[model samples]
Target: MTGEVAGGRVPLPQRTAEARLIVVARAKRAEDYDRVLDVLVEAGIRSIELTLTTPGTFERLPALTDRYGASVDLGVGTVTSEAELARAIGAGARYIVTPVTSAALVAQAREAAVPIVPGGLTPTELFASWSAGASAVKIFPAGQVGASYLKDLRGPFPDLVAVPSGGVDLDGAAAWLAAGAAAVSVGGPLLGDAFAGGDLAALGTRAEAFVSLCARTAH
Candidate 1:
């Protein structure tokens, strides 16, 4: 599906197709978040997910879009309400991600023609989200289930595009991809305690590593 925006039309599937890794950034301060984002973008990580939990995220969305939207497919995550969904779209988010499967939100995204990746852990929830027209289904806290879970899920629903988020590090990212995950969403592992006064350079190196891993193992 396509939706018209300031830049032009946005094709939902195409947007999801281009993202191999989505960096989830949540910082107490916007400046720190920006710093990490710069490092990630410089390391060739083009997709970013700014969580609503971050302070000033909604207020800063427009500026973020203006500055990096051209090169990065910026999106909003941890969304749970229609209001948040609306605000994200207005902020020019290329995609929407939720922590749980919300059929209503999925329908709203479908209407707007924006890609939505709703979180689900069970087969029922995942299938429901996909059936509701979500561009992809995100398996939250995937570390607990591991790559084996994803591979098993594909047995019943081979067509489902599964994205594993939370607790996913560079070491397991390729394994998830090999298990048939459409893409992987990484957070603290890639950030490397940067928000806790760690070195941004370390984060940059980690970003490069993740990007290279994705390249080598992309499905």
Candidate 2:
């Protein structure tokens, strides 16, 4: 599972099944982040994205990676700058995600031989990111446009791999997948009230629901 893109060979992280359901986690505290991630992993969610906005995220990456590296595919998200991208790679992130498409970010990922999922809304933006060598173009706020937008986008860029992020809930996961999305990135709906001291058991239930939804939608 290797391919050359922008003069660099794509790594396993860029070419694996982990992308099918990327769980985005944003916590106010690192401890809460760890707790949520542990529960998610135990619930059978292997792909996890830790947002840079979370406090102490960068500092905790090493230990997090060490603790779950074997069973989890850990990635860093919400990266908006080249410096943050560098920090993520240095912290041993398996993949990198951004909320905006940046040619510089794509180039940096190419240089580091890491996988990057850059965000975009319009078709032009998505194509631009793909042209710049993004492993996958993330359709941020996908809920705004819904699955039909993804279906429409594929009509022109059939080869483009897209991951619908933001506001995607269990009810809509299958629709997104059916619309030709390579995967889906979920946050709040999937996390429920876990970040605000909600029940871990409840979070686990939601995680299982998502996992089940993805399984049923798998082609």
Best by lDDT: 2
Cα-based lDDT at residue 201, candidate 1: 88
* lDDT, model 1: 0.84
Name the regions of candidate 1 deviating beyond 4 angstroms.
1-16
Per-candidate TM-scores read 0.92, 0.93
lDDT of 1 by residue, 104-164 (tens): 9988887788888999999999999988878889998898899999889888898888889
Estimate the Cα RMSD of every predicted model relative to the unseen true structure: 3.3, 2.3
Badly placed stretches (over 4 Å) of model 2 are 1-19
Please provide, for model 2 over 1-219, each residue's C-alpha lDDT reduced to its tens digit, 9 standing for 90 to 100: 123554452433632354378899999977777888889989988789999889888999999989998888888999999999999999999888999979999889887788888999999999999888788899988989999998899788988888999899987788999887888899999998899989999999999988888777776
